[model samples]
Target: MNKKYIQCIGTFSIALPLLAAIILTGITSIVKAHLLGNFAESKNTYKTEQAQIAVLNELKIQHSKKQTQLKQWNQLLTGDSFTKVNERLRQSIADSNKTKTLQLTDAKRSTRPTYAVNAPRSACEFKLEGTFSEMQRCLTKLECRMPNLMINTMSLNSQINSNLLNLKLNYTIWENAQ
Candidate 1:
């Protein structure tokens, strides 16, 4: 009876450790599967973000170009009529201190409708005497005040002293055709 009891104890000890090892192996496999799934899902999310970033970058470039075009169109819509262009030009010249030395002449404008939109335009030619800096400032001011003024031609002649400059410019101003 003693030998039988010892044998039962040995068998119980061996079976207990084996069962525990089997349970541990099952748990390990389940944890490994869960970790692999999480890793795959993370990889997919990263790829999606990369695609979205690429699309956003493209949209940013197009948005800048469209914004510039919209600004130009808005200026065209808000620009002054033919009569105001001369005043704006004179004001710009005055601001640059070139009004006293400026010579303005009216150009031969076509009375017929030339534009597809039937927009009336006034063309004028002007000669200005000043330094390069003054001329640049004058141009800047004219552009700012009269957004729809288009300079068709510009010619510059420098004097012997190089400090004096003569600039001849041809410009056109667009007005809404009533």
Candidate 2:
């Protein structure tokens, strides 16, 4: 009976440590899996946030470009009244005529169709006589000096026995709407 009791105590001591080791390993595995899951979830959330930030940055760049273009367009617009604009146009044409052989034969103002909803425009028809080179120089000066003036139509006819050309020019001036 004493030997049997000793054997039972040995068996119980070994089994207790083995069972404790197994239980501890199971708990460790469960904790590791939970931690790994949380890490994965956080990583996914970070990626989503980064994607949204990139999109917003792209949109911001596009908006900045649009603003710059708008500013440049505004620089090409005149805020003066139609009468003032017309006077300026005539003065410019006269100035061009003085520098070159271009002669202003006739000038007329006509009603022009508006191209923009918020911008008003004026049109003028001009008849001039000059050589081709003189006409070219005059047109170049007008275009470069007055950014608001746009040439809508131009026609040139050569005289039967002369070096001079008859030029018909239609131009439009864009003004800022009040």
Candidate 3:
């Protein structure tokens, strides 16, 4: 080929790979964005609604019904914006009565906890003392009921026949609809 023609062909060959790479990357990004965009339509649209509903469902799973389990679930979920879910928790707790009331303090996270994406949650620190059997029963109750009660610490001290259990129970509730 002539020098000018050869130069044009060389330039096109050199640019071709870069142009192809750019187009491929752009297409990939658009596909990714399209997948993620499916969720961010409006502030309180389908995604938010679904998240809220999931919060309720999780409450149901966590507040699985048992006497003591129900008690804590009710207390945690009550009187908040998540009241509907709390009501569901309350109803679950109403199913049992073997537990006494326990105190829970709203605790600040030293660090923002790792939580599910788009999950608006609040944390509480719960402490309670019970006899060995009672404590086991309580934990069992918690295990049965609470959907999101992350156990930070659990300690048990033996007392006579019944042991004394000092436990720190951490739980979370969704702050917003989700």
Give the candidates in order of lDDT, highest first: 2, 1, 3
Query: Tens digit of lDDT per residue, candidate 3, span 110-168?
Result: 23357557665655444555444554554565545555445544444444654444555
Model 2 whole-model lDDT (C-alpha atoms):
0.76
Stretches of candidate 2 off by over 4 Å are: 1-100, 114-118
Off by over 4 Å in 3: 1-112, 146-148, 152-162, 174-178
Q: Which candidate should be chosen as best, given lDDT against the real structure?
A: 2
Number of clashing residue pairs, candidate 1 = 0
> What C-alpha lDDT do the candidate models reach, one value each?
0.71, 0.76, 0.53
Better of 1 and 3 by lDDT: 1
lDDT of 2 at 143: 70
Candidate 1 lDDT tens digits, 1-178: 5998887887788877888999999999999999999999999999999999999999999999899777765656454544465666667777887445543434234233345565667666667777777778878987886677777778999878656787877776665554
lDDT-best of 2 and 3: 2
Q: Can you write out model 2's per-residue Cα lDDT over 1-178, one digit (the tens) per residue?
A: 6998888887788877889999999999999999999999999999999999999999999989899767855755745434544555456566666546668788777668556555677787878888887677667766765677777888999989988899998888776765
CA RMSD of all predictions: 8.5, 6.5, 18.1
Better of 2 and 3 by TM-score: 2
Candidate numbers sorted by TM-score from highest down: 2, 1, 3
Worst 10 residues of 3 by lDDT: 102-111
